[model samples]
Target: MPKVLDCLVNVHFGEREQPAWMLEVRDKYFKGPQSMYRQVDLAELIDEMDEQGVEKAILMYSIVKPSPTALKFVEEMPDRFALAVNGVDLLHPVSSLRELAALVHDLPVAYTTVGPSFWGDGMYPPTDAVYYPLYYKCAELGLPLCMNTGLPGPPIPGEVQNPIHLDRVCYRFPELKLCMIHGADPWWDVAIRLLIKYENLRLMTSAWSPKRLPDSLLHYMRTRGRDKVIFGSDWPVLPMRRLVPEALALDLPDDVRDNYLYRNAQEFFFGGRSAGGTAE
Candidate 1:
């Protein structure tokens, strides 16, 4: 297997399990077994990662703040894990920015996230001034901002997540490294156009299975988007054991596959280190 670095993983390390509401949503929409939501011991998770050739993974918390369980995972295996903060309250921009700053200040935070549907009841669009402060802070810190850009799995209001909303964001905060996670869905064309228009934006294949990825995105990944895309398992949501092999089996150029698997992520989060090393 080629080197791999999962950009968005929901790790159930320690005593934490995925919240019940989220699991209920997955059970309702997903067609397969709910095995992805099953909790596993940290050591068991590590064994699976090792078995799958995942060099590192960014542990993202699903709620409104960073989870202690994620911190504990990083603390226990600093070389194997990094943190991503999610669900910051855009309603209170100032406090949110401060909390974001504090999280990055005290931890190995790779980036911060905004789940348009999950936060503020899916009312705030990506371009809303409410998200500006967070965007500004991320640009200031040279930190990447990951957002849910497609129709969300949970039945929350999804109009707030249109990929079009990011056009203004990229134009306003040109320096912020923005990553759109989950698939861009119905708006793949718009997402593709915006990615072409913004040097700092990227698309991450996280929750969507590789074979299920839209043809447009696969074409983009194999062609001009080689360096503009990254990989993520959204773990348990799609276990590495299954996700990695499917990704590696894609009919992509070797270089494009390499970039999708790890190289682009290295540049995105680790300043383009050429050697095999963990993401920070």
Candidate 2:
């Protein structure tokens, strides 16, 4: 098996039950039994990753609060896990930047994240000026930014996450490394165009099954877009044990699958780190 680097995995506080909202999401979107959303024991997750040949994973934080437990994982297993700050308040850019700066100063934060549609009633798209400061700060600090794109699974308005909004943001901040997760459905044509147009942008295969990845995306991965795609389980939505094997089973060239599964993420999110977790 190729060494894996999961670009997105939400590891909640160890061994605790998942929140109610997550159960609803699993029921509505994943179509899996309640066990799919069950909380994971961190040690067991590591064993699973090892059994599955996963070298490392990026733990995405909550939308409501960054998990201290998540940070503890990074602190304890610096080589196995990295943190992505996803809970920052987009409406309050200044405070968000402050919190981000503090986290970056002390933690092995791989990147900051935003879910445009999950911003409650504000529903600010990625292009909204409110997010500019975060873009500016992440770029200045050499940190990447990951945002949810396409129609979200929950009941909220999905328009806010349309991939189209990223065009302006990308153009405005060319230095920022930004990734669109959750597979930009419906607007995949637009997503492909943007991925081709922007060198600093990437698409993560999170929240979507490998067998079902769009043909257009698969073709692109096999051709000119290999380096532009990254692997992410968005675990609990899609478990690592199940998702990794399915991904490896795809009819793709070894190099292409390598890029999708780990290499691209090493370069894109890990600052050109080697697969063994050493910086180039």
Candidate 3:
């Protein structure tokens, strides 16, 4: 298998089991889901990555972003990972969003994560005024927006699943590269149409099941023929060992599969940057 760089996995402090929001999410949606995030540590995660041959992973976490986590990985290994930062918590109704923009400047940041599912609690609708400042921060930084567009978490309602709601943000921040995950879930067709229409928008097929690489997703690639799709396996839930092999075994054209597997990510995002830098 080509080296798998899982772009989004979360790791958190084991003792930090009391973040009110997380506890709320656990009570509501994580009814019986394993609490691995609180269980795994760097050594354990690295051993798994080695055993599975996962070359790298970009973390997108709750209390903090992945860039800091990547810094930790690189400090010991110096070349194993990179990250995208998600600044959604800047929504606390102060100059918090703008202040975060300044804080991020000193950090080894990449993109900021947000998704409609995680919007209000999931990806909030792009039309909500609460998100404008965050959008502005994204555009200013030239960092991509890691927008979630997949299965709704239990805490999120059904209405928030549509990816079309992001149209307003796309229109307003044309300069910001929006990386949609899970191919924007059910409204994938709308997402593909948008991708074909705008060069600035991109999507990852990370969580898409091979059995159902939706018609629109396949059609857009076969016809429009762009190499924007990147590999992203929602690791931990779907371990890299399983997800990578399944993706490798898909019935896609060799080139398409390669791009989806590794090329697109190496080109569009990190561009071969060597890892290892702490944010000032």
Candidate 4:
């Protein structure tokens, strides 16, 4: 059986933390209620490790940049964490995609995400030439590239989170492990069908609420290839313990469930660190 892995988690310390307006939206529409994100970050990490019996995580968002935050965990417990480099928010003053590519070139980034963390532009698609090099860099690095599909409300508008927008990139960079996050939310159907058609692409369970997850996602994981699925909680957004039970309870095979939870990521990220050890 595969072990469950808390594939995603983060600690955010910024000048203005979890902005109030976005907080209001998250408080309302995010997977679980505020009750889930109520716990302190480290406490929840320890608690989830105890509750889920899982090992390893991709600790993103140790802000002020990715290297420092990721290094902290990696330096302490090397194999336990896969630190990522932060990509320039499309809305931020991203000088050029070339600059962004160069910034990540020498860093120990397992992979990175292209997103809308800034105030304006959203990473809509690869149609624009700027995103092509970004994809190329990912392919060159051979890292898992996670693209935000759909997480809306203050920060960005709802329309910007669509996954169909990824068509151009997926088509252009066939080898890139472009794992779609959040079931691509409203775009789940498009994403699922696309993955079905294109074997290289994959999906991760980032923020899908069991209560609200569409059946298409269940069918894809159940009927399609479980090996292609990855586990993610969009943590500080949805806790691992809270989300895993719902997924584990599904009718899929135990091994399939395990694969989705951690096995696949273990193989992908650590190349064989699937022994269920978080010890340094």
Best by TM-score: 2
Candidate 4 collision pairs: 91-121
Q: What ranking emerges by TM-score with the best candidate at the front? A: 2, 1, 4, 3
Backbone clash count for every predicted candidate, in the order shown: 0, 0, 11, 1
* Positional deviation of residue 99's Cα in model 1 after best superposition, in angstroms: 2.2
Clashing pairs in 1: none
lDDT of 1 by residue, 31-143 (tens): 54656655556798789889998888888863364466777788898888888887676777777678778878878788788788887778889888888888888999988
What value does the lDDT take at residue 128 in candidate 3? Answer: 81
Candidate 4: lDDT over CA atoms? Answer: 0.62
TM-scores of the candidates in the order shown:
0.92, 0.93, 0.79, 0.80
| Alpha-carbon deviation at 103 in model 3, angstroms | 5.2
Worst 10 residues of 4 by lDDT: 271-280
Worst 10 residues of 3 by lDDT: 271-280
lDDT for position 11 in model 4: 43
Candidate 2 colliding pairs: none
lDDT of 3 by residue, 170-262 (tens): 787888777887667677777877777777777886655554677667656655744877777665544676677777776678878767766
RMSD of each: 2.4, 1.9, 4.3, 4.1
Residue 223's lDDT within candidate 3 is 57
State the lDDT of candidate 4 residue by residue for 152-199, as single tens digits: 545555555576767767787887777776667667788787778766
lDDT of 1 at 99: 75
- Against the true structure, candidate 4 reaches a TM-score of 0.80
Error of 1 at 244 (Å): 0.7
